[model samples]
Target: MPSLSEVISCLSDYDPNALPVAQAQQIIRDVVTPVEAVEKVALRSALDRVLAHDIISPINVPQHDNSAMDGFAVRGADVGPDKAATLRIIATIHAGGGFDGEVQAGECVRIMTGAPMPQGCDTVVPQEFTQAAGEGEVTIPAGAVKTGDNRRLQGEDLKAGKPALAAGKILRPADLGLLASLGIAEVPVRRRLRVAFFSTGDELRSIGEPLDPGCVYDSNRYTLYGMLSRLGCEIIDMGVVKDDPATLSQAFRIACESADAVITSGGVSVGEADYTKQMMAELGDVTFWKIGMRPGRPMAFGKISSNGRNACLFGLPGNPVAVMVTFYFFARDALLRMMGAEENRLPLMRVASESPIRKKPGRTEYQRGIVATGADGVQRVRITGSQGSGILRSMSEANCIVVLHHDQDTVHAGDMVDVILFEGLV
Candidate 1:
């Protein structure tokens, strides 16, 4: 008999500060999980990892101003429409060497891209623009010669002691080059978050097992495993546990002990055989159940005491697509919270609708849809087929979920709906 708001309120009251998704994020903003001190790891091992602490540049990127192009480093007074200056191409400054001699007026240095700028040289005319007419003589183009034309300013990438990356920031491929620019051979990164999930249903059987008259092959666990892997969680799958309370409790214990969070499919709804809810409450005060959302009416969240730590537990609905969607919207945020990720919500874009869709008030709906481009250069979306939770293929072929808020009852063509594109559809 608990309303959605009431359940959220109760959960807020249950924990000291952890509110539901709406407010929980705010409450946990400053509350970062324990960062396991900085561990210096080789740069090769730092890719696709989160920074454990802020990293400041020990040296200026590029070390010093250098030539941005292979050209003649010269003074602005050296080139003009009056006539070509007979400048001696003394020593070629090829990247590593510093031009020792001062570049006098009407003199230039042959420099390559990434070569350090000589002490007195300020401008560079590209080699193409300059023609070598004779020995120790090059043609300077008669054009608007601006001062500091091709100077690669020192600290252009980053200044010494500048914050190159902040703590808790997720690193990308390009970040490696930045780290290298800072001369960081090793990086301090946070430990990976551990997540364990399992599937539970009496009518479920493994793929290899013979299907019974009323049973179906278990797909929730495999799907969840793949999804969690993509989310960067260390997974420990407990396989398929039956509907029995003892078996479910044991499996939950295993997950709670070894994982940062425990996720289980099935046995979360208001069914007579449903035991996950009760077992969660018995194990370690499960805060609430039954969110006000379509395809995820039976979601439970809370903690389960196992070993020394209280691992977070999420009881997802049994439907394969429901499990996936609910996890993406609801549990994924929480798991990211545990991982100390700065951003919780995925990027959602507003896309116009090509067709209308049915809906009812009181629950938010995530209808699968195909997103296509319109002549107006905006993404237009339409529901692929049935908005049923069991339709997994519908979600597969679709590119995004056109999110319908709980307040909206119907959507018309050309109406704008918040669309969340599949993370890896490309």
Candidate 2:
């Protein structure tokens, strides 16, 4: 693994004080290493887990050539383009059943959906498209269906000995069904990432505790829990640690010793008197930075070692909104990488701005927004009132985040702005 400084040295324009958001993201990606341990999990328990190995199909999907719908199976040669043809219904074949005898010319088997195609039959004529001519016979009109119509070819969905799901894929509901179809009862997936997180401050208190004269409830840990839980991480909520040196040092050491990554939500901004910053610097090769982004400007990222065990550290800002923004933009991707999951960055959707937005160049801005579609079917986004970093309610009330990129200026009404939908992230 490359040291944090070594990775930063490779960048041509590395700036500790005013790092661009994208540049900081790239640096964190380059420094962290993925976990190597793998475990066999039941197919039902594999959802959202990263696949440690490629899943190979043992048998062809559908197993054999079958009917695609409830229709009659007939030879295409019997139905001509010029006129209708009547054929004798030799047998009725339902799903999971096949004809015992060969289907001769002018003899069509009545095949239902998912039924295997009988011998000497290729096309299927829908019962509605055909009329009963006489006893045990049906007529197919011209141009109703041609050769191979409604017939599911063997191995069309998936072929045997082929890659069904590639390595590094985060399994979903559909993936589970696919694996079950291939007779995969167990899957090799990367072990769930262990993440230890806590909030650091002298003025913060847990919910059950009585509020002191200058103390407020600690909401960062709960928010972190929700976000980390969505990522499927094995979370270790270490509660709130005081700003004292001994307590902060012990928390850092214990977190590094217990988890693959450690996250703290305070004492990272400039000119802070708290010991959280000092303890982080003394314990590891952590770098504090003033990121060029709104709602989340100050952050620290590096590796910390405790009793020979090391874990990646992410020290975020103290404000509730800043903590959430920094986690989603920075720590979220890093933890996903450590879990051996593929990089699946959230897509930025461009929509019209409902009103003018004040912005300055050289710094990126993440403003809470409410997006709705107009009666004309045009999607437009409006800011959710005030966008203060300390105001957590803005995040709760908004459905999306309007992202004004670095080097971009103010946005005029009706201008197309990039947005990250909360539905995709939360």
Candidate 3:
């Protein structure tokens, strides 16, 4: 494994104090490595797991040329170009059944969808396009179907001896069905990543705890648990650690010992307590940075070691919204890499803005937005009421995040802006 310093040395323009969002992402990508462990899991249990090896198809996907509709399979030469031709229907073939005899000229076979094409038959005319002329006879109209029409050719979906799925893919529902189609009962996948997270503050209390003056219930840990669970990580919720040097140090050590990554929301920014930062510095090669991004700016990132075991650490801001934003933008990809998953960045779509948005040019801003189709039948986005880092309600009410790039200034009401949607059609 390459050290963080070695990775940083390779970058030409690296800054720890005032890091660009893109640069910070690149740095994290270069420093993190995938975990090297594999386990065989049943196909149903492998959903959301990263595939460890490429899966090659053992046989053609369709296995043989088959009918794609309920129709009469016949030789193309049997149907004339200018007039309808009547042919004797010799046999009927269902989905799992096959015909043994060859289909000769002036003869046809009634075939159901997915039935293997009989020998010497190349085209199928749908039952709706054909008429039962008499007993055991069907008439196919001229120009009903060309040769090879309505037939699913062998190996059309996936060819034998070719890769069906590549390594590092996070298996989804469709992937499971694809593997099932290839007769794959078990799959090799990387083990689930172990993540331990906590919150730090003297004024933070857990649920059911007595509320003291100036203390609020800690929601960061609960949010982290949900997010990590969605990513298929084994979570170790260390709860809220008190704002004390020894207690924080002990919590950090314990987290590093048991998990592949550690996350804490609080104590990394200026004006907060210094013990968390001081202890983090002593325990690891962590770098605290003020990222050029809205809602999430102050972040601490690096690897920390405890008793010969090391884990990646992400110190996010104390604000509720800021913690969620930093986790999604930075830590999400890094953790996916650690788990050996190769996923592309979520696509940002362009849509018109419903109202003018105030933004600065120096920092990237992610404002919560409500995307809706207006009376004009065009999709447009409007920002939520409050974009403050502490306003978690804004995030809940939003269906997407309106992204303002680092070089962009204020946006007009009708201008197109990029947005990342939280919900998808699938």
Candidate 4:
């Protein structure tokens, strides 16, 4: 019998031969986490990247109270219901210009949208409501408009020294526009997570090469590279490597030395040519492997400290769909945690199923699905004909993934399932 300490080590150790998906996700979150560091990046290059620090507003948006309409800035007290109050449009104010004179009780200032409201003017009537008959005079309608109806108050959008953007938020297009409104020319963001990827197997070939009878072209790395780049990660596609320990050891060393994280496809299962797992074990400690799932059950994780830098590693399944799913479930979260992302889970949406679907009760499944609105304006989803891990075309056309968790034993035609939106991914 082994000693108690040896038994504890045995139980705690991550076995690439028998790790589950949840276990894998947890291990990744624990082993490789984020530490805040700043990188000065252009606004154009900061999309989808996590903010390393909070952004404060330097100037009050709209610096002063202004008109939201292009009619006239008037003293509302002087205008009566259904009464015509004639006033001299003392001055015209276009965008980027303002009225100079103060408005008397019955006077008005002709103003355009975004123009500063004249002094003593509190409301704006749209040009459509006022009839302009002369060079500088207009009639105010007797049907009195509400005060402040067409005015954008000073500092309404943002106040100086206010938190414009909270740290850890992922930047989107709207965020960029908001930052621009705050007059921010540059942002301090987390430097892109340097990611490296490759595929393995003696039975893999590059797309340009003639296909061998028993081999298939490698596509996982390309897909991984593209998706990671879209997520604002700097990717290094190391290409394909054969299923040999020596070559893998050298390649792994390079990836560990250079990238913040390394990803590979295939050669991680317990088979004769499964050299990646063993090679990784030799180079560094593999966190876990072997998630309980369909199609792509074999996965691997580890940390490698070599050369100049240390990196986290992931080994996805060989099949195309498996590789994509594994990345979403595993590496995506890992990258998020490493990037100081506020959201731990990816964005998900709920949709009702239009037709009955079959599923087993062992593990979770992500089926490619198309989402459309029914007559009631409710989103209904229908799964593609095949959800096989190799069905790349179906995955391409899908807009969502219908999630089937382990505890969900059955689903009916109208049953609701939580579908992860893949609109941007596709």
Which candidate number maximizes TM-score? 2
Range of the 10 consecutive residues with the lowest summed lDDT in candidate 3: 271-280
Model 3: per-residue lDDT, tens digit, 1-426? Answer: 776778788878787767889889888888888999899999999998999999999999999999999999999888867889999999999999999999988999999999999999999889999988999999998888888889999999999999999999999999999999999999999999999999999999999999999999998998888889888999999999988888999999999999999999999888773666678778998788889999888998889999999999999999998998888888999999999988657689999999999988988999999999989899999999879999988988899988899999999999999998988410
lDDT per residue as tens, model 4, 1-426? 222223225546555565555655765666667745778888887888888899999999979999998788989787767577878878889989876678898678888999988899889988898876577788877774766779999989999999999999999999999998887778988877888888988888987999989988888877887779767787888889987788888888998888888998887666733455556657776644567676578877677768657788887778899888988888888888888888668767777899988877767778889999878889899988878898888888888888887657778899989898886664
TM-score, predicted candidate 1 vs. hidden true structure: 0.89
> Order the candidates by lDDT, highest first — what do you get?
2, 3, 4, 1
> Please, what is the whole-model Cα lDDT of each candidate in the order they appear?
0.76, 0.92, 0.91, 0.80
**Candidate 1: which stretches are off by over 4 Å?**
1-38, 80-86, 272-274, 374-378
By TM-score, how accurate is candidate 2?
Answer: 0.98
Candidate 3, overall lDDT? Answer: 0.91
- The residue pairs found clashing in candidate 3 are none
**Model 2, residue 79: displacement in angstroms?**
1.6
Among all windows of ten consecutive residues in candidate 1, which has the lowest summed lDDT? 23-32
* Root-mean-square deviation (CA) per prediction: 4.2, 1.1, 1.5, 4.0
The lDDT of model 4 is 0.80
TM-score of each: 0.89, 0.98, 0.97, 0.90
> What global local distance difference test value does model 1 have?
0.76
Query: What is the C-alpha RMSD, rounded to one decimal, of candidate 4?
Result: 4.0
> Which candidate model has the greater TM-score, 2 or 3?
2
